[model samples]
Target: MIVETTRPATTRRAARLRGALLWAAVAPGCAWAAVRLGGLDRGPLVQLLAFTPYAAAGSLLPLLLALALRRRGPAVVAALASAALVAVVAPRALPSGQPPAAGPTVRLLTANLLAGAGDAGALVDLVRRHRVDVLAVQEFTPAAEVELQRLGLDGLLPHRQLSPSIGTVGSGLYARFPISAGGVRHNRGGWGFDQAHGTVAVPGAPAIRVESAHPSAPYAVDQVGHWRTDLAAQPPATPGGPLGILAGDFNATLDHGPLRALLDTGYVDAADQVGAGLVGTWGPYDGDWIPPVTIDHVLVDRRIAVRSVAVHRVPGSDHRAVLAELRLPAG
Candidate 1:
């Protein structure tokens, strides 16, 4: 007996509806991947690809929709597309099997204080919890500086280089070891584009050069050049020389051309080296719906190997703080 039971029109329509919805959701993801892969971002469009990595999350929507429709082909296609997105953003999400540097490890935390608006106690608590050896703060302001001191940061780290606030430029670097202040170095745009530099002498290891980098934000059209030029002007974190640690809010991302150039200079982003680069480090500022972005970075010379990385939320600041445990070459 040949029994033919055809599917109902309603079921067919529902399946088509689900498939349509799934494709619609995935369209933007495909577009973002195209822009990222094409490398078409330039000038005003440069920051466009910076947020493409976030689209990786959207890829799951298609898979879910395909499941509702019981469509195996769509499920496979959506999954492959999502995997492609992750592959494109790799090195950020990919693991590096390179062995850690020989000798003791140093934990470092770099954060932007949102013009000293972050919680002093929270920042101090973060330091204590992590037992961070070096702390680099951007947008460091007088109020924030005093609060840190009152919260026992000065007593904890002792050595310091706190600068005066000049727009969103003031920065501070505090360490348990002695710090040789290097004065505020102005970037291409000066004032707001300033970075605080210093040299820190660790117990037995060689001294490390630290910079609280806060280049001018490219949020405005006029600041685009300033941002690019600033990143370009910064020196490379070449190994063999004193281990250089460039950390803080770069206001830039790995997708950014200028930042990629900086990384090409024999320096490696600690977070990126350990699969934590995809984590968002900015957002939730004002009323704007800002998605978290990895604008914060801890760039270390090749001599220093990344051990582990982390990101944390601090009240008051729009950006999250990033920390990395780096193993340095034997002195």
Candidate 2:
């Protein structure tokens, strides 16, 4: 009789312990979901938020654990949180519909040259093989420009608006088509990176303005504010104005608030449109051993049709090059 009584009590304790364990499993994911959905990222949270994709993937484990433990409350919470995160992230993997577009197709490539240390031969080879029409380069340096020209970059892309400096602040735009009214804009609110801009005149389409975007990276806690300011200062896509494309290392991901806010202004991520958004363009290439994340992007006017997007590995650079084939509307 005593054995039976003790067995029942032990079972009760075991059940309680399992329930507690389940709650512990599900709580962190739930909190992350709350913060992400609520857009509560600020200060250090900005940097932490870059790992949302990982968080979303991880939320599944706790969900499965809760279901296995048969903890109803924790399971339900986990399910909801997991669903919310997957809903936001999964769309990037699926192709979105494109608008009806009948115009000339243009191939664009964007790359961060890692302060001009990236392989110039590899870059020019990509341009040549891909038949790229526009090339946006970030972290462009004067030495890099000369080396690229030596490798036949100028022959491939005759028109240019370059602002090549000694460090990561420089940017440039090179085009196969004629480019006019080209210049560089220095960031007023951020770390003052130069953004090279130009108006490209494609033969059969309306003149489109292109900018090589290089926002301040949020590496440090204090630099988060500068990062936000840099993103906010990016030019918006105006329907009535010239069609636009912003490409390069934005130092931000789609999950970031400031980047999302910029996207809200009538711009579309080319990779996301063709379901290639999840591909990482930056990370551990410099021997950091970190997992890659998507930061470099080609954001086009919503009216433009994105046919396909590809990411390529550039030797000696931490960033992968992003190539996008886009169709612009007729003038």
lDDT of each: 0.80, 0.92
Residue-level lDDT tens digits of model 2 in 25-128: 89988988898888877888887778888889999999999898777899999999999988888999999999777889999999999999999999999999
User: How far in Å is the alpha carbon of 322 misplaced in model 2?
Assistant: 0.2
Measured with C-alpha atoms, the lDDT of residue 299 in candidate 1 is 90
**Global lDDT of model 1:** 0.80
Which runs in model 2 stand beyond 4 Å of their true positions?
A: 1-7, 286-289
39-119: candidate 1 lDDT, tens digit per residue: 655667666666767677677777677777777777777777777777868657886765556767888999888877888
Model 2 TM-score relative to the real fold: 0.96
Indicate the worst ten consecutive residues by lDDT in candidate 2: 283-292
Off by over 4 Å in 1: 1-31, 56-84, 285-288
